[model samples]
Target: MSARMTDAEARERMDEITRPEKPFNRFRWTITVALLVLFFGTSLTVDISPSALLALPERTLFYLGLMFLPPDLSEVGRSFNAMVQSLGMAWIGTIIGAVLSFPLAFLAATNLASKPVVFAARQILNFFRAVPEIVFLILLLPITGLTPVTVALALGISSIGTLGKLSAEVIESIDPGPVEAAAATGGGRLQRIRWAVVPQVIPEIVALWLYRFEINIRNSAVAGAVGAGGIGTLLVREIQLLRNWATAGTALAVMVIVTLIVDTISGRVRRRIIRGPQRPVDIGADTLPPDADRDAGPDLPNDPGEAGPRTFAPI
Candidate 1:
């Protein structure tokens, strides 16, 4: 038979389970302190009386209840046209940016450019990215006489900087072995780039281009503020005229549709590119072995026998 445990013994066992000296969770403690400060600061600065906050949900419900009424489908045709125009502007801008940035992206990537040139090109890309697209829209309106074309130009210019920087990074991060192999085999710079570097990075760059198209769509929507033409101009007009109901409806619809379409399409495209079949590498019959080129007779008249029947050369 065992002796019955004392109360002190049971308490000691419970204390071991609880571990009183264990450290507090740092993340949780930090979050608690942050919330306390935020609440105190908000209380001190804002005129958010207890009554106002308590009644806030009621006020919000009133506005949402009004929105349940059917949207003014009377202007459906006009709205549809405006949306189409906005889409067209976005499409054109994305095309221009994607096409124009290819060379710049290559130039800015150290793998493709001379070391010095790439350094300078990267700085130029950084400078362009620092300026907001809206600023470009504002600057170009006066010069180009305010049109969808101006918006496209502005969006394209600003996009090139961001696209180039991202593309360069992708290019730079690729495996260097294939490129080195190509170069060591007596391939010229262009040949090495075409066969090795481009093959690895093309899928990623194309994915980036598609992603940029989605972003351009959003940028175009907001470019209308500076007379760069789009649905934003109509939305602005509605707001300025105190058509709050119409403004609210349009704003909500735009937010929902753009978010849904961009997230769905970009996600699908990214997955497809990542999982796509890679380009097959062809080992040419005429391609040189690594050391074969070094043994080739110096550029002088040599007998066919001396050159070993010219079995290998750079592909």
Candidate 2:
């Protein structure tokens, strides 16, 4: 235990440290075997041969040359309009999801809702997450009849799962101080959530919405290919049906450029929201109830006072 030890003592400590038997590297071996199995299984399933692998690069280059040799912009106006439609669908979907997910988040938060409510809300979110957005588009296609609105609705429903789940997590992880203060001031459950919970989580939730919008934009492109109405439909038609490489290239370029612009703007806005004008802003702190601190006084850590059986305190 001394700071300095004799050589014999050091040797004795080393032996003691190394005395336990080392366990087998089962985790490493398991990972290696699983990866091998997956690689071989996928290769067999896809029937990819050594010659095909070697020819992949050459084939890719040949295709690229065909598409972009003299990229045409004859239908540039149409591509631009379709891109706007895709943007519209994405925005509509994001708003719908944002609106729906907000309430579900509260219901799903363990700190806010009862066990039954939480369970039900979470199951709803899970079902949304489990199914792809394409499936929802398919279901809505018949009723809505192949419009951007249908894609928007599908994306909205799809967004609920992720938004709800993430928002719930954000709700649960908020500063407990605000909740405690609300309770101490005799605020009921709803008041506590409104005054305490919303302010803390709103910025993050909005940022998440923006991020989801970026995702929905991409999803819109895929939906368009399946007859939802966007640049995707045009791009696919030019390439597959018309075999017009120039037009296809133009459409593809427009889609990429537009998507990138949206992504860049959204990312900047999300950063601004997260890193607010004041990080962890305490807006209108003067409004806090004066009597709660004065009348109650400072209680011991274990005190169960006006805020009956206090679970959280200001940090």
Candidate 3:
């Protein structure tokens, strides 16, 4: 009994010794403090004040009330027209961007191109991505004037950077097995890409293009504010020049409705594209052996002697 008690005490002590300890992470706390200080310091440098932030909600509510009161339906016709124009601009721009970026994407992909090519392609993409659509519009306005074409061109040019970058990432992530298989079959670089990479990445790339289209729509509306020929122009005219709050509110509402509808449709399509096709499971078939039928054939002459080992002459 004493030995048993000693063994139990030993086991208990072992458990205590082996148990894990949860140590306080002083380093984590130190990092958190440092980040907080940096954030506050930056906020101070930017002249961001807590008092101004606190007053924002009340001011926002007041503005909303002013905009919504007696919502004007008179501008519906013009608003709808401008909205349609914006949609057209976004569609054309996105299509153009996708077309132009498709080739650049392959060139920029590290898996497909050399370091120098990838670096140069990435720098070009970065330049376009860094410039906003509005800036593009500003620069092009002199050439294209204040037309919807200007907005479309601006949006397309800016979108190429994003689309190319994302497409390159997609290309880089494609499965190498098919590519290797193609090369094994004596395929050249282009042939390998056609037979292997394009099939695997096109669907996702297309989905990304659709997503960019949705974004471009919103951007096109904003571009219109600067007289680029969309609802935004009308919106600015009513709100800033005519001071027709009701008309401006109507235009804003129309823009929101159209944008929301496009976003919802595009989002659904993107999800479907990403999920790919669903295949039905064959539960019974899955359980069956590959040679089940052959295995079920009459037991190969239980005794080879009984069947007298049959032989056939070669044809």
Candidate 4:
């Protein structure tokens, strides 16, 4: 009986370790009810005339039936080519954003590190985050020839701001003790960042990268509407000709399948990152393998001493 009681106590203590305390807030329920009421009232007031409302249910059913068209297997080859192009654009854009965002993220995490240069970097990140991707596509259309490059550039630019801000937030929230330890050990600015900050945030950053890839896949399709050249152009053409059923069919199929596949893959990757090492344990302590070090590279410094490295401010 005493042993069982001790075991129960141990389990209770373990549960406490895993369960975090939630900060209480009084406004959440009130805010939710207010928003719901406002939306319900606004929707009721909107004059959705009788004919349109009556047509909606029938149209929905008709489109739902179109899903059984056996998937236009004849157009498979053409659709595959277009999908490949859009995916290529997504890949190119994601790579560009990942490459650009690394150093910028270090600069943007101004709350964790309040260097004047870092503050400036944060402002630049804010500028990029504020602009919508569609707007960038328009701006890039004239400058860069209207090819996949234009779409890729627009997606990449939009992604950089989003990724930088997210990465910065992750960096800012890290425990400062590790950073202090690294500095105390005589690690240089870059080394300190490498050993302390990047080690902690790499999993979060990789998760973000995967998530951005999924987002870019969707964005690439939308970009095709502007002659960016993908399914969007096809959808636009169908809509212009009043081929509503076909347009609806293609959209529904693509949205369901593409989203499912990307979501599944990204979820798996994110889970792997969050969980501890899935494979054999590493015994090495101080030194990293040359390959690992080479792949990751040195981390960017948060501290901007006199004359920091010249970095492009995002805007």
Taking all chains together, each candidate's TM-score versus the true structure is 0.69, 0.80, 0.74, 0.71
lDDT for each of the candidates? 0.71, 0.82, 0.81, 0.73
- lDDT for each residue of candidate 2 in 253-294, tens digit (9 for 90 to 100): 889999999999998887777676544445544454666546
Task: Tell me the RMSD of model 1 versus the true structure.
Answer: 9.5
Separately for all candidates shown, the number of backbone clashes (residues 3 or more apart, or on different chains) is 0, 0, 0, 0
RMSD to truth, every model: 9.5, 8.1, 13.6, 11.6
Which regions of candidate 2 fall more than 4 Å away from where they truly are?
A: 1-23, 47-55, 278-315
The predicted structure with the larger lDDT, 2 or 4, is 2
| Tens digits of lDDT, candidate 1, 1-315 | 248778888798787896468677999999999999999998889876888889999987776655435665565456556666777777788778888888788889976799899988888888778998888888888898778888888888888888888888878877787778777766698878777777777777777777787777778766657645567766666555655665456554664576567758886876566555344434352465566545653432111111011111101
Output the number of the TM-score-best candidate.
2
Give the winner by lDDT: 3 or 4. Answer: 3
Question: In lDDT terms, how accurate is model 1?
Answer: 0.71
Distance (Å) between predicted and true CA of 1, model 3?
19
* Lowest summed lDDT window (length 10), candidate 4: 305-314
Model 4, 160-206: lDDT tens per residue? Answer: 88899888877787767778877876788887788778877777777
Q: Report lDDT (Cα) of residue 107, candidate 2.
A: 99
Off by over 4 Å in 4: 1-50, 115-119, 242-255, 283-315
Residue pairs that clash (backbone atoms under 3 angstroms), model 2: none
TM-score of 4: 0.71
TM-score of candidate 1 versus the correct structure, residues matched by position = 0.69
Model 4 residue 17 lDDT? 88
